[model samples]
Target: MKKRSHISILSAVLVASVALTGCAGGNSSAGGNNASGGSSTPPAQTQPSTSGSSGGTAAPANGGVIKIATQTPLSGNQSSLGDAIKTGAEYALNKRKEEFKALGFDIQLFPQDDQADPKIGVSNAEMLISDPDVYGVVGHLNSGVAIPSSVKYEEGKLVMVSPANTAVKLTEEGKKTVHRICARDDAQGPKAAMYAKNTLGVKTAFIIHDKTAYGQGLGDQVKMQFEKDGVQLLGYEGITQGEKDYSAVLNQVTAKNPDIIFFGGLYPEGGILIKQAREKGYKGYFMGGDGLDSSDMIKIAGPAVEGVVFTSVAGDVTQTEEGKKWADEYKKTTNKPLETYSVYGYDSMNVILNGVLEAIKANGGNKPTREQVLDSVHKTKDFQGQFTKVTFDDKGDNTNADVFIYKYDKEQSNFVGKAQ
Candidate 1:
C-alpha cells in the first residue's frame, strides 16, 4: 500500500487559486460561495424526438450499428460502481432504442471495465478508439479514468459524456469533445466543505484520500476550502485504496481527534475505513464524495455508516419527473430500480441523442457522419435533462447544477437528504 501526498496538495492549490481570484473581486462564487441558482427557474423544456406514431418521415436507413463505449470499474474493488454505470446506460438505450430506429439508425452500447485503474482505463480507451463503430462513449466512473481516457477520445474525435467523473480539470479548458452530465469534484468538494463549516459547525477536520487521482484531488479541494473558511486543518494525508486493513491510518485519525473526517474516494475503501475508524473510537462526522454514496457502503460499514455525511452531484435523479418515468419503465422492462450512475448514464444518452437528432434534422435526415455527430454534441445548448438543465460551458461541464448533501440514516438504510 503506497500513499502519496502530491494530489492532496494539488487540491489545496485549486482552492487557493479560486480564493485569490475572489480577493481581486468581491465575487464569492469561486470557492463554494452558494452559487446554486435559487429555485426560480422553471424546469427546462427539451422534448424527446421520437417519430410520429403513423408512418412519418422515416430517417434514411443507414443499416449500421452505432457504438457508444464505456470504460468503468466492472469487476474489481469498484465493481459496484461499474455495475451501476452499465445498468444506467443500458436502461437509457433500451428505453430509446425505438426512437433511434425511427431515425434510421441502430445504436449499441459497448462497455469496458477499467477497474478504476488509470493504466487499464487508457488501454480500454485505445481499444474503443480502434473500434470504428463507436461514435460516442458514456463512462469511466472514476475521475482518474475519465481524465486520461478523455485524451484518447478527444484525439480520435469521439464524443465522451461522463455520467460520474467529476474532477475540475476534466473540462476546465472548456473541452469541446468531452462533456460531463454530472457536477465536477470542485463543485462537490466546496459544497461538502461549506456544510462542514457552516451547517455542521465543525471547527477542526482531518482530510484523507485514497492516493488515487480522484481521491487525492477531492481531498485537496476540501482541505483548501476548509482553510479558506479559517477552519483548523488538524491533519491531512493520503491512504491507499483497496488495502485489506486500514488500522494504521485509523490509529492516526483517532489520535487527531478532529471534529470531522473528510475522505475523498469511493465505497470499497471508504466502507472499510469508516467502519474501522468507528471501531477504533473515532466518533465524528465521516464524509466523502459521490464515490461513497452507494448502498454498498452501508453494507460494508454496517452500523458505522450511520450519521456519516456525503455529497453527490447526481441528486437521486429518480426524484425528477423524467427520472421517475425512466425508473418505472426500466423496472417494468428489467424488474430493477435505477441506481448509482443510472440517472447520469441515461441522461448522457438523452443529451448525445438529442445532439444526434438535431444534427440529422439539420442535414435533412441524411445519415449523419461521425464528424456531424461530433459537431452536434458541441452545439448542445439548453437541453432539458432528467435531473436538471443539461447545458455545457466551453469546458464540457454543466452550467448551473447544485451539489446535494446526504447523511446516512440507518433507519432508512440509505443516505437521506438533509433538509438544507
Candidate 2:
C-alpha cells in the first residue's frame, strides 16, 4: 500500500506536468455534485389524500384509499439515490398500510419521478395536487426541483415532506407546505467546512459546484465557512451537469495542488469527478455534502473513492438495534441493499402519515382535509422516527436537524459521527 501510494504520487507529479496542455481540449478529465442530483433527487408524491387513524382504533367513517406521493427521481443518473428514498417511503407506507386498512382506509404509496428536473418536478406537483387523492408528498431529491415543485404544493396547500432537499430556499421561502427532515445547506455546508478544516486538517481547498440550485447553494456555504476558517481558497469553479469530461477544471485543480477538493452536487457528478481526478493523478482528499451519500459512488469512482469523506443530512440507521432491524427488513422488503437515505424516506413518510392520524383525530374520527393534515405536520413536535426525531420549527425545518460526516471505505461509506 505504501509503495502504491508513492507510485501514485509519482504518477500525479508526471500528470501534473502535462495537465495544463490538455485542459483546453476538455477531453482528458472528469466530474459535479447533487442529493443526489437524476443527476439530483427528492422523495415523491404517492397515493391519494386521506386522514390518518390512531393505532387502527379510530373508526373514521369509511376507509378509503389514502394516497401519499413520493416525488423523487426514479430514472436518470440520480436514480440510485432517488430509488433509495422511494423504497424507504414505500417500505414505511407498506408496513403500516394494514393500519389504514383496519381503519377502513387503504393507504397506498404514490411515487412520482421528478427526474431531477425542476420543470418536471413542478409538473408532477401539479398533477399530484389535481389528483386530490394524494394527501401528502414525500419527495424530490434535488433542491432545484424541490423549490419549484414546492411552489405548486404551496399553491395547492398540499404538504410535502422531503427526505433529501437541503437547500435553505426550500423552506425559507415562507412556504408553509414545505418540510424536510434533513438539515439545510446552511447547516450542512458549514459543518462540512469545519470537518475539512479541523478534522481533516486541511489548509487549502478548491470548491466545485454543479451549477444547480442545491449544488451552488451548498458550495457557497462551504466556501464562506472555509474562508472564515482561514483556509486558503485555491479556486472556485462550476461544472456543467450531465457532462462527462471535466479535465479542464481538473487540470486547474491539479495545478493548484490544494489540500482538498470539495464538490457541491450529487453522486453522479461527484463519482465521476473522484474517479477521473484520481485517474489523472490528483491525489488530494475529496469531500462533499449529502449529495455524495449514495453508495453508487463506489461503483462510479471505484477504488479511487476509498477515503472520500462527506457530510450527509441522513444518519446511519444500522447503529441502533431497531434501526439495524429496520435496515434488514428494508433489504428483505425491497430485495435490494439499503442506501443512506432509506431511513430518511421512511421517516418522512411516517411523519406525513402520522400527521394524517392526528388530523383524523382532530377531525373527530372523520376524514380531514389537506389543510388539516398540513397543520398537523407543521405542528409536529418530538416525533420519534426510526433513525431520528423530528420537530418542525415555524419554518417547517426540523429543529434538531444535524449534519453527520462519513468516509468511504473499501465496501461502502461508514458514519464518522455527527459534525454538528
Candidate 3:
C-alpha cells in the first residue's frame, strides 16, 4: 500500500501500519511547536488538556520528560482512523506540553505505523516493549488487531492504553497492563441488539460477519443476545473479506424478510453490503458497531446508509466545551476533519501524559523509567480528560463513560447522535 505523507489522506493501509509497528521509522515527520512548560497565555477558546492523574501514590510533586510510545496504522487500509487518532492525540499532547513542564516534566510520543493487521499489531507491541525509553503505549484501532497485540504488552509489563480497541477479551480477564478508553464490543453489541428489538421493534434479524476476529466476535455476541431476548434469528452468515459481490448473502437475508439486519464488520465492506441490500429491496434498518461509524460509509453505501444505526464511544466531542476546543485546533492544525476516534486519541494521550507527569514529579524532576511510568498508570484514578471523566475499573475499562448510538443522515452528510 502507498503511504501518504500527509495525515489528511486517510486510508486503511496507513491504519494497518499503525496496528503493526510502534515507533518504527516512517514517512517524513510533520514538525510543529514543541515548547515545554506552562505558557502565560492559553490559546484563545481552547483550554489546554485538563487532565491529571489523581490519587496515584507513585507520582510525586516534582516533574521531568516522559516518553509515551503510540502505535497506529500510519500507512494502510485503516489510515482514516489512524490519521484521526494521531491528529487528536498530537493536539492534546501539544496543548498540555507546557503544563507538564511546569510540573518538571516533558512528554514525547514515539509513534509507529501498524497497518492494522494482527501480526503487525503484535510486532508493533514487541517493538515498543523493546524500547526502554518508551513508558507506555497507545493504539491498535481494530479489535482484531488489539486482541493479540495486547498480549505482548501484558507480558512486557508495559501498559497498553487503547484509544479504540473494543474487544471484551482485551480487558475482561482483568489484564492489569491493559486499559481501554472506549466501551467494549460486548456492551455495544447488546446496545445495538436492544435497539433492534425495542426501538425498531424487529422480530427477525439477520446477522452477518466479515470473518475477521472483530467481525465474528461481535456478530456472535449480538446474535446470541438477540436470540436470548426472544428475537427471531432469521439467518446467520459470514462473508469473505475483499469480495466484490454480496448478493448471495443479501438474497437469503431478503428472503427471510427480517425486520432488521446487523453486520459485524468495518465500514469498507459494511457500506457495500448496505448498498447491495438496498438494491435488492431489503428495506429493514441496517445496523453495525463503531466499525461502521464513518463518513465514507455514506459514499460507499450511497443513499442506503440513510437511517443506518451504529454505536460509538465518547459521542460527539464537538458538542462539549472541551470537545469543541480540541475539534477546532485539530481542524486548524491538520486542516482536516475529525473522525469518530479522534477524541478517544486525544483522551488516551492525555491519560498517558497524566501518568508520565505524575511519575516524574514523584521522581523529583528526573526522567521516569518505563516501569515507573507503568506503575504510575496502574495507580491512576479519577483523572479528568477532555472527552470523559476517566477512572479505569478492575477490568481496565473506563468507568461511567457514555456510549452513543448514531444514525447516518445522508442529506446532512454526517452522523446524528441518537438517544439509546
Candidate 4:
C-alpha cells in the first residue's frame, strides 16, 4: 500500500505559519482571524491524481453498486437540519457520480428519516447494514440518535462517519467504525463559556437543556467551564422537548436575572425559550451550541433572536475562497443557501468516497470489502475537502477541528463575523 504524508505536510505548514505570525508580533484583523486561527491562504481544491492501472488485483467481473446511506430527521421539528445534511451528502454523491462510474461502480444514495429518535435511527442502521451494497453511512445528525445507531453499524462492520455529532462520548467509545468530522462539545463548550465571560461580560448565567444526550452533555460541559471561570450559575434545568409552553421555566429563569441564558438544545425548543423569555421581560444575551445553528432559530424566535450568538463545530465556509466557490455551486445545485452543517456533510461524504477510491486502488481495481474501506478511512490524514482539512485521531475525532462563534445579524439578515 502507498503511504501518504499529507497530514504531516499540513501540520508542518500550520506550525510554520503560527511561528511566523508570532515573530511578526502583529494582531490579526477581524477578517484575518476568522475562527480559531488567523487566516492563511488555503490550498486549492483539486482532486488528487490517481496512479497505476487497474491490473494487479482481480477486477470485478461485472460492474457493482456502492450505496452511501444517510440517517437524519427528514420530518418533525429538526427536519430543517436533517434536510441540510441530506442535501449536502446528496450533492457530493451527485458531483462524484461520473468519477465512480469510471471506476466501474454505480454510486447511489439511500437516505432514511430517523426523526432524531434513537430507536428510529437504530432501525435505519439495521436496514442499511443489512444491505451488502451499503458500505458506509453519512449521518444521524443528533448525537443521541447516533450513539445507538452506531452500535448497530459496529456490529455489522459498517463504517459510520458523522458530519454533526459533537458529543465527546461518540468518538471516545473506542468504536473503529464510528468517526466524526466535527469538533467535540468539550472543545466547543469552553470557547462558548470564555466568550460569555470575556467577550459578553456576563457574570451570571442560567442553563437549560432538552434532556437528550447531545443537549445534556453539552450543557454540562458549558456549565463546568462557566463555573471554573467564576460565572455564577443561577439555575440549570432540563425541559420536555415537545412541550408547547415554557412560561414556567422562563419565569424561574427571569427571577434570577442572569446576564446570559444558555440553552444546550436544538432550534425548536431554543427558539421558543428565547421568544418566551423576551416576552416575559428577560433581556439578556442567549447562546447555544451547533444544535441552534439553523436559520429556523431566527425564524421561530423572530425579532427576539436578533443578536443571539451560537458556537458551531463547523466554521463559515463561505469566507474562504474555495468555500465561496463551493457555496455558489451548492446554491446552484440545491437552490438554498448552505447551512452550518451542510459543509460538514459534504466533507464527510467526500472523506468516505475518497477512502472508497483508495480502498479500490489498494485492491488493484477490485471491489473492496467493507473492512478494507473501514481501514482506508481509519488511515485518512489531511484529507482536504470543502469544509476543512480532516485528520482523524486514534479516537475517530478530527484533530484539526476548531469551534467558531457566529451571531445572528438582523440588519444583514444573516449570521456574520466568525470568532474563536
Top candidate, metric lDDT: 2
Model 2 C-alpha lDDT versus the unseen true structure: 0.78
Candidate 1 regions off by >4 Å?
1-62, 320-325, 411-420
* Ten-residue stretch with the least lDDT total in model 2: 24-33
Please report the TM-score between candidate 3 and the true structure.
Answer: 0.81
Q: Is candidate 1 or candidate 2 better by lDDT?
A: 2
**Which stretches in model 4 have alpha-carbon errors above 4 Å?**
1-61, 411-419
lDDT of each: 0.67, 0.78, 0.67, 0.74
Whole-structure CA lDDT of model 3: 0.67
My TM-score estimates for the predictions, one after another, are 0.81, 0.86, 0.81, 0.85
The residue-by-residue lDDT of candidate 4 on 1-420, one tens digit each, is 011244233324433443554422110100000001111232222121121122122333234677788877777778887878878887777766555544456666777777677777777788778889888888878888888888999988898888888888888888999888888888888888998898999999999988877888889899999999999999999888877799888888989889999988888888899889999998899998888888787778888888788888878887878678878988887786678788878888878877776666555455678998889888889787776678988888889888888887653234445546
Candidate 3 or 4, higher lDDT? Answer: 4
lDDT of 1 at 204: 94
**Lowest-scoring 10 consecutive residues by lDDT in candidate 4?**
26-35
lDDT for each residue of candidate 1 in 285-377, tens digit (9 for 90 to 100): 888888786777878888888888888876775555765776787657655445656666766766676665555554444445667777877
Over 4 Å off in model 3, which ranges?
1-66, 99-106, 411-420
| Native RMSD of candidate 4 (Å) | 12.2
lDDT of 2 by residue, 207-315 (tens): 9998888899999999999989999999999998888899999999989999999999877788999999988899899999988887788888899889999998888
Cα error of candidate 2 at position 204, Å: 0.7
Compared to the true structure, candidate 4 yields what TM-score?
0.85
lDDT by residue (118-231, candidate 3, tens digit) is 666677777767766567777767766677777888888888787777777778766678887777777777877887888878888899988776777788889988988999
